[model samples]
Target: MVGDALASSPGGYLLVLAVLVPVIGMLAMPVMGLLRVRHAASLAFATIAVGVAVVGAVGWRVVGSGEALVYGIGGWSPPLGLALRADGLSAVMMAMAALVIALVALYARPQFAAAETAPGGRRAFGFWALLMGLWSALNLAFVGEDLFNLFVALELLTFAAVPLVCLDGTAATLEAALRYLVFALVGSVLYLLGVAVLYARYGTLDIGLLHELAYPDFATHAAIALMIGGLMAKAALFPLHLWLPPAHAGAPAPASAVLSALVVKAPFFIIVRLWFDVLPGASHEAAARALAMLGAAAILVCSVVALRQARLKLMIAYSTVAQVGYLFLMFQLTIEPGVPAWATIGWTGGMLQLVSHALAKAAMFLAAGLIAEALGHDRIDELAGAGRAVPVSLFAFGLAGLSLMGLPPSGGFIAKLLLLSAATLSGAWWIAVVISVGGLLAAAYVTRVLKRAMAPPPEGIVTSPVARSRELAALALALCAVALGLVPLQPFDLLAIGRAGVALP
Candidate 1:
């Protein structure tokens, strides 16, 4: 079954390139910087262009062919060798990572641009290199077929992301970085423990083999529980989310954008893989409800926290936690038996929420950065001059806010609507109520910032002008979030590709 499902397709080699391109660029960055610091940024951007194109090609092939693109290393099949595979979900995630990373590179270019003889080129060069490394890890996480291979991807992701938080070298940022590292390391340990248990039980670490061989035994149950608990911490779900706000708020804007938009999603994606692919039959309705309960708590608790934040970036960071809650809700809503989970409205809604939030949150972080630049501060109270100084950014932030608020003609609205429908059909009244309440809370927090920004500037406060190019980059991302609303209000066929007969894992 695993072999039949994973046979290499026509464009399978693209998956190998998808992982390799950014890695090659990451290795080349330091060499370029050593020769000429300005050349490093150029190399990173060149890599971004090619990487985005490669990911795009993969997505196109997946959608056009409606098959999983698979490439086994050294022409050896799984369980004995490695493989990279891109199904619909993998393609979409890779595309999302590529798009967000590229836009972030654009936004960071002006700020990090160094002269041929600039003294502090290390910071600039580090940003480009780390960004490449992050991109590489993300692609690997999305495509890797072996469990231990995914573990390596997760480790690379953590190391690449930790340094991004403290790029400025401030005491506070360094502390935040260290805190993030500790939490991520704990997650890695639990995840590895689970993988070890699975390997000992089944003697192979390939996902497809595990899917075929796994049974609802004590070891399997315990291993999955440990792995899920660890992933929840990495994904910043509810009670374990303490490290997220500080790290995201402390990082530079471009770094903040990718961290919030793409980095955290990687773990959540793995959680999905574990639940649906690795142990589908072992999943219980009670356990599913428990996960949704935690998600509800996150939505309620984090939304209130966001509303209370005084700093713009901190508020956005808290909002990320709340938005992530929506993804967890999908676990329960997608429990319809005899139907593939990917074919359900809940799955579509959850995926839409992920994509929309990624675009919107990236835009909001970039906009907040520009707003901070214009006023030399991010205090929500002092944002009165932002509308006058950087109206484009303010507008971009508001547009992105529309998605969070679940307003009409935006992706968030469609996503929540679908979730609400699934809850209604399944008689999950509590989930339905939480979805609605989450929207209201989102609106309250968004309006709190917008109202402040629209007010007149305080007496004698002058604002600096931001570059239009940077402002437009943010606006473009926000627009993409809005454009997702055009997708039909149903389970997407694109997402269903490569998921036939497979229950949601």
Candidate 2:
């Protein structure tokens, strides 16, 4: 059945192309020269459009057929050669990444445009090329099957991302970028060490092969713990988050949006793959509980810290950390035996939370960027009456905030609802309580910003106009998050379509 699906599926080749196409463009950028950089943006948009179409087509296949699409590399099957697989979750992530990339590219043109006279400058070329590189690396990370291969993709992602943080070369931003690079490198070292142990024990790096072999030895458990812990540090989960706020808040607006919305997610996704796919039944429940506890700490501590931030960008950065905590709640909610088959709701809910947070946070960061660009700063206290100056940006911020707060008719609401239901069914009352408190904290932070935005300008306050197009782009992404709420409340069979062949605990 898997072979038949592979033979018929177009997504396999498309998956490879999705990762390579942007990289090819990145390599071609220097040759194109500065006068042609604008065309590079157009090329990027076109490539992303093609990628999204392919992913959408694959999503249709998954939903229609209720199965995954898999392609054996070199026709050599797993354990000997690498394979690429896409289920509903991978499809959604690919599409979401494409959409966010396209939007950021569009929004960047005005902000990143170089003067015709100075077209060949460093900023313009560097930004465009690095953007493409970042896109390629991210797609590769999503579809990669081998642990070592994924480490390469992760390194690519980090390299592409770090320079973006320090693009301006300002002292403060450079410092933040250095901090990020060091911490992420530490994470990579730990992750690579874990992969080495796994390969030593199992003789294969492919996830499918590892799943089939089911390494239940002490080496396997230790490797899984190390890999997951490394990923958590890279993902900025709580204590390891020392590098996040500064790096994210200090970057340029477009850079900040991408870093916050998509970059951190790659590591978190890897951790999910580790625990759920590779390790499966071997996962230590105690360890999972410890991870969830840290997530809960992140929620309570970071949400309060976000509320206390004086700057809009920093508040959003801290909010990203808090939102990340919610994704871990699934560990506790989805692990119980005798749980209804419908309990996959928690898994789907976690994914929806990831997708919606990406879209909404991207929009919020971009809106904050526009505000900062107009007023020359993002001071929350000074934002009074700023909404009148940039109503569209303000509206975009509010709409995105609605999703973050888990309000009705938004993806965040549905995600929280599913998670809460799972918690109730499993009798994990604390998960439900934490989720509820997180929502309220979200509401508090969002409302604080909205209230200040809508109020009359304080005496002596001043504001300037922001670009309408950028504001609209942000609003569009926020609207997508709102639209995700329309998906029906169910087990979300699509996510499970490809899992039957893979051994699950």
Compare the candidates by lDDT and give the number of the best one.
Answer: 1
Q: Write model 2 residue lDDT over 1-505, tens digit each, in one string.
A: 3453433355567667767788877876665655454455555566667666766776776667666666666655667677777776677777888889888877887777773237444676677788889988888888888899899989999999999999888999999999999999999999999999988887999987788886577888888888887888789998899899999999888889899899999998888788778884633668767877888889899999999999999999999999999888777666756443224787878888899999999999999998887777899987877787788888889989988989988999999899889888878788888889999999999999999888987687677677788989999988998998999987676566676532322
Q: After superposing candidate 1, which stretches have Cα over 4 Å from the reference?
A: 1-7, 36-38, 502-505
Distance from true location, Cα of 345 in model 1, Å: 0.4
lDDT, residue 117, model 1: 56
| TM-score: model 2 vs. ground truth | 0.93
TM-score quality measure for candidate 1: 0.97
Superposed Cα deviation of residue 462, candidate 2 (Å): 4.1
Over 422-498, each residue of candidate 1 has an lDDT whose tens digit, in order, gives 99999999999999999999999999999999998889987888889999999999999999998999888878777
Task: Return the lDDT, model 1, position 302.
Answer: 97
Q: What TM-score against the true fold does each predicted structure earn?
A: 0.97, 0.93
Q: Candidate 2 at residue 428, lDDT?
A: 78
Best by TM-score: 1
